[model samples]
Target: MSSTDSSQLQQQQQQLAEWKLQRLIKSLEEVRGGGTSVITLIVSCKDQLTRTSAKIAEELSVASNIKSRQRLKLYKKTPPNGLIILCGEVGDDTTSRGKERKLLVDFEPFKPVQRSFYVCNSAFHLDPLRELLTSHERYGFVVTEGNGCLIAEVQGNVKKTLFRLTASLPNKHRRGGQSALRFDRLRAESRLALVKKVAEAAGEVFLQKDATVSVKGLVVAGCGDLKNELKARLDPKLQNVIIKMVDTAYGGEAGLDQACDLAADALAGVRLVEERRAIGSLLEAATREDGAIRHAVFGTQEVTAALRLGACGRVIVWEGTELEAVTRRHAETGEEKVDIVAPRVAPVVQTERDGGGNGGGGGWEELQRVPLIEWLDREVAAKGGELTLVSDRTPEGLQLVRGLGGLGALLRFGVQAEVLESFEESKEDGGDGGQERETRGGEEGDDGDDFF
Candidate 1:
């Protein structure tokens, strides 16, 4: 496919992997099992999966083939980020006999697994995976007020100073000499030069080898207006990304430390602001009175229908949504089917919690549960659409989660949700293009790789 198509597919795949990893981590935290019953495995991308699988063939033989066959086989070669699997039998509690359940989850970690490990323990090993999930994005900090400047970058939690420069400003004469006025002029020029130096150093620390800003955000901090002066001296591109201008009692390393603590709120608010923007855009389109030209649709059933009909594109889902992609068998006919929905009640989980939910003698028997995000990713990727996960911390986000049923989408064109739902287009032959899609810049990519 084209470069644009490749990038879009990669993004969707990343989102899917992220969703699965988070869901697994949350569910695994609650699991309790015998010392030698629950198995946890971590393999780095450098390791060969074929060899690893052969080593654990006996250990994995017990897992359900229907559930694991594709997962195990998909990586004829290992993925770029490696793999993490927590599987095996576990009880409702720490003891072996209360209630037994099969728990299995396998997916790529957020970052590459640095080392390989395997164990059967009372609880699933999570510390290593948690470390990998820590974001690698860097944040740049410039702490200075015309003297003892500190330019540093923070990756994950570690901070490394890029430079520490004492200002070269002229010292004023003690006596009220005729040259005392000249020293003040020299000091002003030196300060301006210092700001320019700090700005250049910050650009170096924040940008990558290709000149792209690698830092997620920049925080300029120091006492007085020096921080503001430094921001103004920064490159236009860097100036635009400056998250905060904080004040500190000191400059250099001490101020750098203080800036980290002081700018914490701004750093946190960056993500919350993005979440609001994502949901706010969707809400705007959804509430517009122009029915014939409105590109917004909400509610899972309506959004799913729009997606399948090849209309809606940008999908925004609440990060904390409890919806699941499920399959149910007809109580009488026993015919199986797929559904994207929320659980009727609080879900009791483990292996069967998602993949094999069933009604306790209810008329509609639940069949399987998968994360709703995964299903949305597939449809969104197929249409070259964007998938955003909006957090619930902001008011706009709450409107999306509470008012929009936790999911909403903006269509490629203005198509009524009702009309799109009932518009049944016949499936074309396999040799012919199956589902016709609105051309998005280029013709819709027909390459159907399982970007799970």
Candidate 2:
């Protein structure tokens, strides 16, 4: 192939590699190994690539000795950068002995870890993975009527019903007569009592287990008006946790299952809800215009500056944003540097040759594109700040992206009220600009106004 063709091929390969890495990151973020027998193993291939497979096999052998029917599976076909993750299902026996075992798998060739180690754990140990992925999610579910049940997504689809209550409610209809009027009044009182009982049950679950503290949001569903009445009667803590309310045909476990299915979109988009809340908090604080609590900043430059100063408490960025960064390298010393820049800008180039006659030398490469969300995620985490990836899946997220330049931050310390006021002013001035930018560069069909 010609030099041009070779260069194009290399660039394509790099793009493909980056894409694969991103895909793996997303997969790992979403994966939650079910069952108590799930095992996760991370091994370093730095010096033992040749023996890595055998080392893994040995580890599995030892694990099998302790856990029955243990089957080890690699996330990737080949280890990337001398790193491999082995996730095993310890008690899986669905595969026939005569047939080859097929395991649900995903791979990440490169992970942020310093050393190689093996761990045999039940319940798919995730702390090791969370260190790199930084996914903290909490979800809850509630199904109620005359009866009520509350479940939480402890992990993945595995839900543990935290509370269950059954109340005998009075009949809905009564015959017309003076006696019937008394019966109707009695039934009204009975229904009211049932509502109180259901609310008390929910409050007990929320308070005893501290569900409000851990559950990010909840879905409530049920037949009849009982669900609404329960909501009205619930304590403020329980009431605030409700994310969605749906009408269901059943109650109890079946109702919970139906609620889960109906609210799958909300549950799956919990991150979006979180981002909305975070952004809303920032907006609220900004509106106060209180200098002591004016600890919020928006726009890319301001957020980056705040993060660098360690003032960022949380970083929020729109889901689909690309940023330009510059990478510089020295010729003789082999020193390197990188700096973030605005998107779509041409890369800066600086070349230098050593004293030798040869043309080979280090140079600065400009316009290297990076996923802004990924970069900000790492930056915020490294700075001990929470990172929220907001998308158009939520109205608040859309507003953030469309009105606030697709980036914002909650600071650790307060800034001058004028500074935040300026941000709001800039937002007002550039709100249309941001929307136009999204229209031209964002995902097609995104109106920045529709509710998800």
Candidate 3:
């Protein structure tokens, strides 16, 4: 070939490389920051899978123009499915002979705001992959000869190592090549907390000086009497949380059984079932849901909803329901979560007729469903919003149901009954107001005005 022709070809190739790098940058810039977007990249290399995959990941990270300067982790694997499962454009694929290795790339994007997590896998040339993972045309990489896999993460706009695990050849399979495959599979199955998408304030409580954070698992309990109680008691005012409330029939302590059933429905998503340490962590970080909390003064629904939605600036739930599990969803984000109480339930009791009994002997009930103590918990979490539940000074109690137990709170203000039951007509002192109101499906005077 003539010298002039060769020089022209080199110039054209350089232009193409620049164009591809620009395209990748544009694509990455679409993701917002502050834990809103998450990206995961997995690469399977056959010949030099580990080295090649690492190189590509570094390039992609640099190329991605995320708003928050997010972190990116590249996982490497060499499994039996490496050939079929991996996809990406590399230098070797288009050549006459597979002499040179090609790089395959894939992209996965997550939007916490949308409550959606998606995966996209594709291939790219080695030159471009390296350019995108790291900004510069070339960056140094650590390539271990025997290590099969590695994982890295970026958070708060800075790349940091959350955790990295490598497979060491086990003696039992030392003689064969397949030993690495078993190790890779086992590592993938183990759970890790890479995504800390929960709110900042919520995250703080989990990291308290003395308190430890634990995520047990998530169990869904459909709507029933227990669900109602949960709604009435534990519901918060947060938005975009990750909890789901369905309908069912059972009630009482057995209500938890129905929760197990609901949780089973999500068997396909085993990760959701994994329990965290306490309900506080979930509530502090969960996204918002579609429904908004209706403010009612006489009952717990309004207040509980406010707390669950992360709206209550300061809250206090009665001591009776302490240490109970609460399921709260965000009003805007539809993120649902289960909250485990740290201290316990502690609520003040007041004497009042059952309203259902004729002789006023059924016993008094709490003026509010959740006690002031519980409200305090939700209030602390709703700041800027964050919720921080402090250790309670009052003693704890076991009585879950209030009102029926004669416990109540001295709310910020005297709760207006209309606020609790928005549907009920306001009480008036006129002559025609003497007749008592009756609940649906209940006979007139059967439960009496003093029973509820």
Candidate 4:
């Protein structure tokens, strides 16, 4: 294949992988392990398969290891890039009446793993894989106060401070009768010097020779408003992408780490901000258009119909979408067609076809069913369109799922739902399809009424 063709193919593969991983993360989030029974084993290309096998055998005494070991043996050889296996007893662990459950999920990633690791915790250690899904773009981190300032960069799993400075701001001369006005004037001059020092150092660390910011985004964090004063003197390009201004209880290295924790939500939402903007654009076109030449549509039926007719421009789907793609065939005409059906009804359709067939009185036979997430990716790419996955972390993401049925698209030309939909769009359960109970998360009681 030509270079352009190869690049396009790679891009499509990445999109499909991203959708699959997003669904995997959602599924893993729902799993609740009983105490420290969950086992997470990540095997990279560099790890020895024999040693990995030995470790699994030794872990047989653990709650879920027997099954995990058996599953591990199925792979005679290690995957080229690597594989992750997360297994444990996952269910309601708080009460005696709660039922017991066992879950083992193993898959090879689309990219190579740098190292191998193992852990047993109440919940699976998902940080390793999450890093793979996160943007590799670096971001600037600035932490400063009356004492000092530290400038750093964070990219994926690493954080490094490239510049450090110590400032000895003036303090009142309490021993002698030093003039109050003199002390105050000296303090202001020191503050001005600190600002200029920070500006020069920031340029050296965060700017390129071409005069543009080196990082994709920037986050300023420290104890007081000193960081704000410093921000004003930084390059205009760097200021534009500032993700947050975090407040910490200390300055220097300790405060830099603290700032990371405080500003984590902002950092995570950097990618979501772009996705939300796209949703807003699609929503705008959807509301303004009229008649059959409509520009926007929500729900599975409208989006699928548009894609089938080569009219889809942009497609956005929820990370936890419930629809499954099913292939159905006409019994009378011997014709085949594809449809998105709810999981509950898909089995019934398959059983009906197995017994014989039924449609137009005889019935349409269900031939095959693939994952909706993967199917949607392939469908959109086939038509030269892009698809994005959104989580319910933000208000717009939640609104899209609750009001728009979790799947929507912008269309080049409109398509009628009646000509496409075989059955009514499936209603999602009260905004909790794959509800996760995070150990550190405190928003379990939230009903999300504020977003509306």
| Predicted structure with the largest TM-score when compared to the true one | 1
Please provide, for model 3 over 1-452, each residue's C-alpha lDDT reduced to its tens digit, 9 standing for 90 to 100. 69865663453333233333344444333322222123233333234454533444565643343211122223243333222122222222233434323222344311011111122322222332333323221111111112221111111111222223243322224443776777655543431111111122233322235443311222223332322332332213211222445454543223333333354443322211111111222333222232342222212434443333334432323222323333333233233333332222322111123122233333222122322334343344334222212112211111213321212222232333444344232211111111112112212222111110
lDDT of 2 by residue, 40-74 (tens): 55554454443544665665554464342222232
lDDT of 1 at 164: 79
Q: What are the RMSDs of all candidates, in order?
A: 12.7, 16.6, 28.9, 12.4
C-alpha lDDT (0 to 100) for residue 90 of candidate 3? 23
- Per-model TM-score, in order, reads 0.55, 0.38, 0.16, 0.52
Clashes of 4: 5
Model 2: which residue pairs collide? 347-366, 347-367, 348-366
Candidates in order have lDDT scores of 0.66, 0.55, 0.29, 0.69
Q: Encode model 1's per-residue lDDT on 167-264: one tens digit a residue.
A: 75555566558977777887778888888888888777777788788788888888687778878888887887888888899877668767766787
What is the alpha-carbon lDDT of model 4 when measured against the actual structure?
0.69
Candidate 2 Cα lDDT to native: 0.55
Sorted on lDDT, highest at the top, how do the candidates line up?
Answer: 4, 1, 2, 3
- Would you list the rank order by TM-score, best first? 1, 4, 2, 3
Candidate 1 global TM-score: 0.55
Instruction: Pick the winner on lDDT between candidates 1 and 2.
Output: 1
In terms of TM-score, how similar is model 4 to the real structure? 0.52
